[model samples]
Target: MAGPGWAPPRLDGFILTERLGSGTYATVYKAYGKKDTREVVAVKCVSKKSLNKASVENLLTEIEILKAIRHPHIVELKDFQWDNDNIYLIMEFCAGGDLSRFIRTRRILPEKVARIFLQQLASALQFLNGRNISHLDLKPQNILLSSLEKPHLKLAEALFGQPPFASKSFTELEEKIRSNRVIELPTRPQLSRNCRDLLQRLLERDPDKRISFKDFFGHPFVDLEHMPSGRSLEQATALVVEAVKKDQEGNFSAALSLYCKALDYFVPALHYEVDARRKEAIKAKVGQYVSRAEELKALVNSSNRALLQQGTCARDLLKEMARDKPRLIAALEVASMAMAKEEEGQDDGDALDLYQQSLGELLLLLAAEPTGRRRELLHAEIQTLMGRAEYLKEQIKMKETRWEAESMDKDGLSESVRSSCTLQ
Candidate 1:
């Protein structure tokens, strides 16, 4: 809605429609190209009178940044126009609006949904960091969603409700920021250990202690390696090709690992694909891949059991050899616990975590140990633990895929039944 005397600025090619939003210096309008009404955009009109020296410099910097950067998750700056009274910035229009409103509508997001958003945001941040650019004004309101039905994060934002710190006034907020107070994470919605760990690292009050962009990108919870991107399809295709080759070579373990890694990209690629036909084709291919992966999983599991049995004697020897070294012994104990958990046939995710922890410790020990039999034994133990972790990861992914498929099928059946009842 426009004010009593206000009107949208007339641009040469765009027909400005309803007001989208407003700030101190600019008002945004939903607009469409006069030549092609189907082509929609957002026009930010900044009044000439509102331009201070600092703001004008900021506007120039923004224009340059937008022009030089091109990323799928980033909004595009189509063009800019100016008149005596106002300056108009023609930008990509996001139909889904900002993430703040999105989260407000949903109240709380599921952990999976939150992780997807975090991954997208982390991907964008990684790009910006590479270019030595910082998004200083990051908030949920600044992060836009791509669409209503299939939302993709287009910018930075808070994942959950409210800021980690709540203050009643600007002074209070300033004090809190300056005080370097610890951030208290809410416990209402139980989160996974990795998720909590990431939050804690991210919210560290001391700048020196806060998680760096590299660590954030590599964090287990973020898992940016598997995040969907424009290159996801290409990457998945490449990996699957290698996977098939390995499968044909009778390298079941190698093939299974490759297949699991490929699916890490393939699932994301499936979500990234928009064409209905292509999506269906990918879905079909994924089903085939999954079937083969399941077969490979069984084969690999059998082989791993044998390897573990053979390694048991070596492991016992290493434990006895490391008895004098408490740290090495402790790592071996953790590895044993991980093996026990894996054999229990429950909580593959927990087993994977334990295996990772043990490997971390053993690898550190290996790095410092002198060049000797103990070092070699530690190396072997680390390799064994890594293999176990990889296998557990594959098992967890397969179970997740199965659960997702079942959920989708149940939803379809429910919809069909509802339609039948409506017809009756």
Candidate 2:
């Protein structure tokens, strides 16, 4: 992380042997831990430069969520470390890639096979929701296949595909494939139609309305309480806290799982303080990088609308760009090129088009209407945008209305009352 306040060199303790994958803000590395066993683990390395305050807070929230969840379907966090510039999260290495890759390679899996995985996933969800934690991002990439091999043996010879063995009966082929592959097929459990329906409810998108333990696990699909575990919840929390404390002391990215452990033990106020301090530290550090950008002015102008929409932390980052206001203004000048003709009062087709596009960006920022000290400045910007959008709307009659209220006027006519883009 090349920020101004604090930028640390990457850690040298772990030997990075292979690239695992890249994520939105971090890269995954397959590395060997420096401990006695020299165990291989996947490290998720996030640069302080990439993490905004919101992202930092989200990371902590995720840690707290994971700390309380004890399920076979979920991946486990092993450790965390922070260097001068980067934070490294040591986690369970799932040799089998995420569910998305598996689904992509195999296309539609057999209903029975999919059901088994779904059952496991539902069990995990059931456990989390029991504790009022929701997995906001629930997609195939986050849903990992078991590191443990499945037990099912191959039942029959390949039908459309060529045989692995040149000479073997279908029955003998089944026996050979079963012996060769560690996996074995299990007898598919018969699920009632209602149970299948219940599974869909558990996977609902709306976090608030999603099914809970009371829904699917009024009678659970599986017995989570009786599931095997190497350590009790208390023991796990202790280990996690120890790891977190070590990472915090070493100035490494503290393990999210450990934060969750600490949260489990501490009061809510304490947890909030710990999280807030981390976020503040991240913001101060990131502001330094933003300040040093060569295109600081242009970057600020271009990012203004987005910053307004995202609010608080983004606004804070933008405030730091004042150090290089000249550069930022230069960048904004480049950004305004497309609107140059419109600004000059030209009403040509190109000018109209530019005006409309610029108005959309401006209106989007206004629509968010963020608060704090920047509220008045943001309001002025939004009003300027709305004035432009209103002009374009008159010129083009851009047939725009949505179920959600347009602007903040609520008492006016809605779609049911009239049909000609009426404001309410």
Candidate 3:
């Protein structure tokens, strides 16, 4: 049904059922094609009377941009038409409403779920960035979900509504915006350290100090390497081909790295694959890859132990050479502690943190060190620490995946038991 005193537009080849939403200049409605297929879509109808010169230009620019781009995470602009009274934009219909509604209903999302959404958003942003475009009014409301059961994000136009801020007056909102006050995140729903770090960087008031798109894309939390996308399968296949080549060459270490990278994409590819037969095939391939990777992991671990033993003298020499540089020595000590922690096999998370800290310090020192033996040693140390950190991340993800699968199985069994008891 339309709003009071508002009649739905009569567009050819379609029948508007009900008003879905409306903004200042336009109204969106649920509609279906008049043909037998009866394909559904959302039609955004903008009145000519409401358009000022600036607004008209903005509309034209939006249409041009939407028409020119096509991405998996972006809502598709099917077509457009205009009559004397209104212009219509036919868009892909999303059944799951918007993220704002999804979040509100759930109260607070689990960190895993939030991370998935963030990755999807980042993927969309990465695409726009490649084309030198920006979404000026990005918000939860402007992000649509494909379906409620298994939501896939779709970036869409903003629907005018009450802002998230709780200022009582326009003057108050203006003061809040102008003020140099720090934005504090809520503590009620405790967030993970990576999530908190990303949020803080994103909310940084100074544009110069804020995280850049490149850094954001590469962030550990974003983990674009494992982000599900249309290209996930293609990327996984290419990496696997190289991984197999390296494996056959007996380059176990390099093969292990490539296999890990491929698995990152393969996991996402499995998630993206819809057809049951294809999904099962991917699962089988993944199992084979995983088995080979485990073998390589053991071989790599043995090689690493040998390398560590051989490097002991070199490490001692490097420390003696860097005695004049106390900060560099301290960073080296931290890196050693990270290695010891990893060897102990007690806390990979803590080991990863120490590795990150040492790497951060060593990278800075290396940048300042002149090209020499000391610089070479420092760069090698950084690379080793980075590799360890990446390995730990993969281990963590595998554990998390196993736990989630077990949890789902338990949930299904419990539901089945409940249903059987009810029937009895």
Best by TM-score: 1
Q: By how many angstroms RMSD does model 2 differ from the true structure?
A: 27.9
Cα-lDDT of candidate 1: 0.76
Query: Model 1 over residues 1-424: C-alpha lDDT tens digits?
Result: 8868877778998889899898999999999998845689999999989999999999989888988887766777989999999989899888778878877776666565666677777767778899999989777777777666665442112445667666899998888878856677777687777888998997778879899888888998898877756688799889899999999999988888888777777766655666768767877887888889999988888888999999989899999898789988888888888899998988887788889888888888888999988788878888878878877877787666555433433332111110000000
| Tens digit of per-residue lDDT, candidate 3, span 1-424 | 7558877889999999899888899999999999999999999999999999999999999999999988767888989999999999999888778877766665555565556566777877889999999989887778887666565432111111223244899999888767798877766466667877887787677999999999999988888777766688899899999999999999998887887777777666656666668766876787787778778888887888787778778788889999999999999999899899988989888898998999899888988999999888877767777888888776665445434423432332111110000000
How much lDDT does each candidate structure score?
Answer: 0.76, 0.45, 0.75
Q: Which of 2 and 3 is the better model by TM-score?
A: 3
Candidates, ranked, lDDT = 1, 3, 2
Query: Which regions of candidate 2 fall more than 4 Å away from where they truly are?
Result: 1-12, 67-70, 148-192, 199-213, 219-424
Candidate 2 lDDT tens digits, 1-424: 2236632234556667566677778888777867788877778888888999999998777666655554555677766788777778777666656665555555444332333344455556776776777777765666654432331101011111122243457887667645634332232333433344554464354568776556555533332331222232344346445745655574222332233233222221111122446434433432332232213323433454454355545434544543445543332233254345544545434555554555555445445545654445445543544444343332222111111213212322111110011000
Answer with 1 or 2, whichever has the higher TM-score: 1
Off by over 4 Å in 1: 3-5, 36-38, 154-159, 171-184, 276-278, 404-424
Question: How displaced is residue 178 in candidate 1, in Å?
Answer: 4.9
TM-scores, in order shown? 0.85, 0.38, 0.80
Number of clashes in model 3?
0
Error of 1 at 390 (Å): 2.7
